[model samples]
Target: MPDQTTNAEKLDRDAVADRLTDLTEELRAGENVTVSVGNKDMVLTPPETVGYKIDVIKKQSRFRGNHETVRIEIDWKPR
Candidate 1:
């Protein structure tokens, strides 16, 4: 069986920048990142080598105006 996890949130620009900064530091230090949502949490440690992909989506609606999403995906084989 494969394990799956997800975390989603809504935040303002400043908060989003802070979150990105934290993620950058963690990646630079090669540390596991802990994902927590409510009372549930998980830690993910990436392998020494990994593959990366970026996906971007743009949307527009009569009522919603314009919206964009950027998703980054990482993949690696287990050691």
Candidate 2:
């Protein structure tokens, strides 16, 4: 049988990704926010006034089988 533990780990990672997405949106909306992942938390504040720019990149990788794998990548330049 496939490893059930691996499935659970994947689900947990997906949840984290969803949270990160939400935080990114909030940051772009000019909200000061802090995000915690694992043992680290990042505090972000939008630039003062308007016309500020922010760039974000996210990458993920997963191994599915002996020779199968998957990756997800997102790039954003917030205005």
Candidate 3:
């Protein structure tokens, strides 16, 4: 099976933006991106090119209300 790590949490807009900014900085510097969730950390090095994908989903229901979700994925092979 493929190795997988997952972290899920609810944060304010600013917090979310901050996390993205940190990741962007690392990528821009061509350094390994350090992903930390609680106490676990995973280091990943992305090559010059990577696969990027984004998905946006919207759901509407009379009783449950409306909700929207955005998912972003970035992946690359190991050197």
Q: Candidate 1 regions off by >4 Å?
A: 62-64
Pick the TM-score winner. Answer: 3
Q: Rank the candidates by TM-score, best first.
A: 3, 1, 2
Q: Look at candidate 2 and tell me the lDDT of residue 7.
A: 20
Per-residue lDDT of model 3, residues 15-74, tens digit only: 999989988888898878887775788888888898999999999999999999999999
lDDT of 2 by residue, 31-70 (tens): 6656554566655555544343454555455764334434
Tens-place lDDT per residue, model 1, 10-64, is 8899988886787667667776865555367766787677798999999999898
How much is 56 displaced in model 3, in angstroms? Answer: 0.6
The candidate, 1 or 3, that scores higher on lDDT is: 3
User: What lDDT, from 0 to 1, does candidate 2 have?
Assistant: 0.53
Candidate 2 versus the native: TM-score?
Answer: 0.33
Clashing pairs in 3: none
lDDT of 1: 0.75
Model 3: weakest 10-residue lDDT segment is 30-39
Pick the winner on lDDT between candidates 1 and 2: 1
Most lDDT-accurate candidate: 3
The residue ranges of model 3 lying beyond 4 angstroms of the native Cα positions read none
